[model samples]
Target: MTENKNNRTITWIVGGILILLLAGVSVLLISEKKVNKELTQEFELEKEDLENQYTTFARQYDELKLTVSNDSLSSLLEQEQLKTQRLLEELRTVKSSNAREIRRLRNELATLRKVMISYINQIDSLNRLTAQQKEIIADVTQKYNAASATINNLSQEKKALNQKVTLAAQLDATAIEVTPLNKRNKRTKRTKNIVQLKIDFVISKNITAQTGEKTLYVRITKPDNDVLTKNDADVFAYENRNLRYSIKKYIEYTGEEQPVTVYWDVEEFLYAGTYRIDIFTDGNLIGSQNFSLN
Candidate 1:
């Protein structure tokens, strides 16, 4: 009996130790499951944060590209944006619990930020250079405009001076006289007795006038206001157009007062009224006179 009781006690002690071991193992398993759940939640939060960071970086790169005007710089920005986009896609696809991939993405984010800072610096430098160029161009344009205005003013002044000189060099006529003559070359007052009309004038002395052989034109108008010309082709240049002239004569000018006479033969019937005569030289109407035949 003593032997059986000792055996029973030893068996009971072993069973109790087994039960305790099982309880301890159960508690350990529960604790391990809780820890794993907490770790998974933390990994999810980290992955979400990393993804948000990549998304924000991509937005920043997009904005930077829009602000860039240089082709090379814009291209670099585009490439960086694409890189960020690709990383964002990778982060989306990666498992939430993947610590290695998340760590890699974090490192890439830091690198991209540094690159963005460099791009910003370059862009600012280019903007400053462009502003300086604009200022230089504006200054040059202003100077050109001022020079053009000065040249224009000088040209106008020269034209005015030349006009004054031209006017001063023009010749003048004085003492104009007209007479009616008969066939015997005697001065006549009767319309039927007149056979010709004569005009006489004196060219006043002008030191500024040129000494040369000059052509003079004469126009005679009857009392009926009809001009007498040899034909429709009897024309001379006045201003910019051809004007009818009754006769033309050439004379030598010596810059001294000189007498001139021009005659016109009358083939048409003469009337007992006043007749007008105009004399022109060098595109100017130098003298005018009137005569009457009763």
Candidate 2:
């Protein structure tokens, strides 16, 4: 009986140890599962924040691009777009808590950003087009004014010139740019066929002269003091001594924001030198601008 009792005690001790070991393993597994769940939850929240921020950023960028008047700011925009794309890619690779559903959400978010980028580019292009159109209109107006002054007999009346000078010059003209259509937007160069410039002025509504034709001339001055002249007598109406224009344009004065533009061919071989342009018409110098070619 004593031997049997000792054998029974040993068996009980072994069974207790086995039970304790199993309990510890169960606790460890439960703790591990809880930690994994929390980590996945945190990651999901972070991903959501990133996605929301990226969307907001893209929207803001588009709004800002619409207002972009300076070409220098374009570089900053492209950089922001690249960063968003990289973040979207990273979001895609992130391991979500639920391997299926969360991953799908991240992928969807990335795709949305990609689509947004495309839309942003399209908006940028549209804005560029609109800007170009305004420039063309201004150019036409300036040229028309110049041609009419030379051709119209009514402009010879001194009182008429004074009346126009007083009112038309007071109305403010918003400056519009005439950048080349094919420009890459990364740099500024005179080598392109069309070199765009901006014209800003004010037109006064009250004038002494009866509404008729007003002549405006835009003469580009090269570094050699030689004025850029044109062969078209209509666009190349005389300003100072020569037929002055690098790009000749004509416009009729309805008197509003007269943003004008003219084109220069690459065949001109613009050397490294300082170039300037002056606009003349309506018995008032409307505007002037200058830039360098290097």
Estimate every model's Cα lDDT from 0 to 1.
0.89, 0.61
What TM-score goes with each of the models? 0.78, 0.37
Q: After superposition, how far is residue 93 of candidate 1 from its true place, in Å?
A: 0.7
Clashes of each: 0, 29
Cα lDDT of model 1 by residue, 2-64, tens digit: 999999999999999999999999999999999999999999999899888889988888888
Error of 1 at 291 (Å): 6.2
lDDT (Cα, tens digit) per residue for candidate 2, span 91-196: 5566655556456655656676676567567667867998899999999999999889877756576668876577544423224233332244333554453344
Model 2, TM vs. native? 0.37
Candidate with top TM-score is: 1
Clashing pairs in 1: none
The C-alpha local distance difference test score for the whole of candidate 2 amounts to: 0.61
